[model samples]
Target: MNAIADEAIYSFGIDIGGTFTDVILHRGSDGQSISTKVLTTHLDPREGAIIGVRQLLEQWPIPPRQVGRVVHATTLFTNALIERKGVPTALVTTAGFADSLEIGTERKFDLYDINIEKPAPLVPRELRFEVEERLNARGEVVTALSQETLAAVVARLVEQRIESVAVVFLHSYLNPVHERLAAEYIRKHAPGVHVTTSYDVAPEIREYERTSTTTACAFVKPLAEGYLRGLQNNLRELNIGAPMFLMLSNGGLTHLEEVLKNPIQMLESGPAAGALSSAFFGKLDGYPDLLGFDMGGTTAKLCLVEQGAPMLAYAFEAGRTKRFMEGSGLPIKISTVELIEIGAGGGSIARANSLGLLNVGPDSAGSEPGPVCYGRGGDQPTVTDANLQLGYLNPDFFAGGSMQIDAPLAGHAIGRLADQLGLSLVKAASGIHILVSEAMASAARVHIAEHGRDPRHYSLLLTGGGGPVHGYCVGRKLGVKRLICPPSPGVASAWGLLVAPVKIDRVRTLQTTVQDGDLQAVEQSFLELEQEARGVVQESAVQHQKTFVKRLAEGRYKGQGFSLIVPVPDAALGNEQGRQALIEAFENEYRRKFSRAPSNLKIELVAIRLSVHTEDLIEEGLQFPSRSGALAAVKQVRKAWFEETGGYVDTTVYNRDLLGSGDTFNGPALVEDAGSTLVVGPNATCSVTAHGSIIIELH
Candidate 1:
């Protein structure tokens, strides 16, 4: 491979998704970027990323040695937990609490159904061992840990050949003495096994969530370690001497070492990157409030971004038995960018149900046997096949002509479904397309409503491989007046990693009534959290820069079960003015969420959160190459389906790369690029911005 100048410096961002691996190589000096996508190797995800990286380096003729930093995000850890492919693990909890995971707050996701199933615990009762340990809610030891019992438990674990163990004790979040002692003994006796402690993973009050999160970390620890180490060694073999960083589920980048300790923090890493991409690109194009819509092969994710920041939630569920049901999954207590995911994507299988109604998926044909249109041995018809039948995708120009697709194969598969539904080909295909879009739109509506936001007020920012292909219909369903499709929408998540800031989030649970709380102690606690968070962020930073810290607290009425998060002032809370400010902040947030605050209830503080980060690395803004030349001609005219046209109509097709800034086109058109395609419906006006993004305004 050819090499660029020795002085040139570059950064690499790789995102491995369910169906594709996206790689972007960015030149730091001038903000130039080149990206590519390749089918993910399910057997080994790293192999696909390495292949994509090699292709970009060779195609751009840039030396691997000049690459300054490498940032990556993947769904491997989450997939391992969902598929139950991780190492055999065991949970160790306080005596008499071995069935806590099974009991699970005794709540049912479906209350009315007589036959309801909850997700099984990761650790079976046979493997779960308990020890004599007790700590009160005030962090006072009620009963000291019994060394004899713990020793016996350790021996059983080693004898059973367990690969990993989780040490969890009641009230460990308040005082981790027993948990730490147990972990130390286990590590000393079983040197070959991995250990995860609830205190270290999640220092929160919820026992079920903490135990679940800890066991999850233990289950995926060995796999993540091996994968990360193998990837580092592979990069070195390719002569890319760069520091590696990982994107977290909270839309921040951290060093690999931090991630190895708590791999559960990366549960939503890939989708978080897509949300950040929407915020970044949306803000650049003069829109701050937006609804991020990312549709890939297996799933579609929707997140809300307001004022250039995505919403964040402190807890998330994984591997849900019911895709839309909230409590049908494992609870993980990690801070994550709030997102609503629906099983509506390009690869979602479509079929006729027993009741003679058409049904799309909550299941998908992943990259292994992708969509039928790819000719990859898939016989079931998918949304991609329906789109291909509807003329939304160009067979000859798909994936920039890098991968050839068979339209006839897609037609045959979709035709079978049409025959089952007793509908014409065009109507059947359109029904599938519209069905998936409606699913996404319906989910987005509920998500937005929950956040107290209106769909019409927010512009829809579309990304991912399938996002642009179906964005027009999805946007119209939500009543959005505008849609923003950024450059290289297919690989936008990878690009998001490059532009993300080094960030860390830290939290501690401190239960106290606000009216009688120790204000000085709370202030001291915030300082300590800030110090810890800053240390981590500093370790991830390459150079010294201005650091920013945000303080937030979760509070609720004294007798309530849950709390609401509110921003805390930067001033000292010991004084009357500061105390009053804190009270008002909670009241205002409470009113905003519930329409009113309780008149006679005292507010109790539950947790304090700190967010630390360095300024964005790209302050000068991303600059796209100025396409100042004359507007190029349309590539071809093809028959494309549109409801307004009543059938397939001869539509204008333009090469995206050939369209310059200020080029305007009225739709019943297709704009084809290497990574994805933008289908513009009739009466919609499309314009190319100076940043090379397509802005579509609908009537």
Candidate 2:
């Protein structure tokens, strides 16, 4: 059949990681789930994705048209920025302020360091031309944009042969007349070049972030669009004519058309999926606070989840030279799920530095060369090699025996590292393991401290292939006593896409003082904002189950440098009581933040935010019945290294599929699955939950 018009309802979620292409196919009618992990084709991620989807569909017996939806997350744009591989882009801004991206906030993330490096601007100085126009903070055009000014800018762009152009006039977030005029002119004059404006991409406060975000969007617009269109056409050719969706960095799904125009929103889309999975699973288990730990082949991401919601921030940085510090990269004024990522994963390379000291990564081998054990022509020692040498991995059972790992090659690689360190192979392997663990802990500590969260109150949920292998040590360093490992943790990120809702978040700057501002004006502004946001959602062709809206305001003292978000009740905000209620809400939130609120200071409302989204598009169904099979066939013993014991130990190894509900055991133990391994550290107790996940208690 060319199409299955009356077939069962099924959906697919795809995530492209550095080393693997993870796919999760699920039946919406009954919650049947099938997952697969295949090595990533770095040259063309779509090649690996098609293979995985084809294999999954063949095995699960789902019809092509029965796959109603496909949600995707990829690292293409982020990697392009880091590697400086985007299209040739130019920037056009207000004449006097064209260099705002370089000026930044002028505050060094490391104040005492004299030689801190910042990533070069996406639009270099020579290519950043300026139009002679000005707009005051209130959006008043001081010097109205003229035709002559537009013509000159277009001439320069055409002469330089810029592939794309970004227009970022000052105060465009408040009013966009000038920016729109400039963008329209460039579009008409430069027929073949693409255009992006700050008003369309990031209509928010802060000039530097807006410019940076717009520039980034312009830089990747051409390349990302071509890649996505190629994949979409390929899928259509396969008789899978489903509407494709792309994941946003805010843990929501939007149509591919939206992402192609605003590529900056996809910078952290892959990592955000893991955080969303964390929040969903945490809510199901009655956990209000948790720490998400996800380590794949290239990196480890840590996010703080509170009250079933992952933390969110408007300001984000990408491609940082200093991984732990801010202000070392380009700032994007886009709302997104907040998380910290570091280079500490299975494929992280190990090297002896010029100082002759052992150094683990901030660099990864990725999928092309992978690790020494993968036998993919890699000669360098990596974390995977260390794990194999320490007996944490099984050589023959890797990738469910589909791919074989060479243990001898791994040992040889580790032996070279051991020789340089002047230590035994096991000792060097232990050092590599511990150093990466410490690096992960350092990233988590900085991330949590910045968010003002205490680690003792949060349990660590380990996802990704590399997370559980190092979770015990990292958790202990962060004072986390409880760890939860979900079933098929490595594929959780992809599964998150199947549950994501179609969402659109919009923000507009409206500077108003609470003491003297009109409540009627506040009520009117929010209504306009809600309508605008709703229009965007309604434009999409996807049919949502339910729809709703949430109104929020960013508030702070008149002289404060930062602002806090507070919820506003729609009905109460139209009268005197609503104004009173808003002030009280601000006071309550302020006291919660600073332990007290100043009664004398004036509270100024900075911005209005609107979040419009559909209700849970998919039903909650991660739970699975415990298996009734015997464990004797899957149970075995292996030699595993344990730092607590200061040597190798006989660790019990069990198959994850054979462990049923109510099954309990004590570590040292290793639980194997098709795609990942869960390590139960010494002195910990593990139990299988009703959902077939593992819960470990160290105290």
Q: State the lDDT of candidate 2 residue by residue for 420-509, as single tens digits.
A: 988899999999999999999988888898778888889999899888889888888888889988888888899778767667788888
**Candidate 2, pairs of clashing residues:** none
Cα lDDT tens digits for candidate 1, 1-699: 111232337889999998889999888788888889899999999999999989988888877778978899999998999999989999999999999999998888999988898988899999999999899999899999999999999999999999999999999888999989999999999998999999889999888988889999999999999999899888999999787889999999898889988888988999999999999889888898999999999899999999998999989999998877989999999889999998888889999999888999978997879999899999999998998888889898888888889989999988999899999888889989999999999999999988788999999988999999999999999999999999899999998898788888998999888887888788899999999998888778756567899999998999899889999986688777778899999999898888989878888999899899866666364678766432464888889998777799888988887788788888888888888888889979988888888899999
Top-TM-score candidate index? 1
**Per-model CA lDDT versus the true structure:** 0.89, 0.84
Worst 10 residues of 2 by lDDT: 1-10
| TM-score of each model, in listed order | 0.97, 0.96
Best candidate according to lDDT: 1
Listed per candidate, the RMSD to the true structure in angstroms reads: 2.6, 2.4
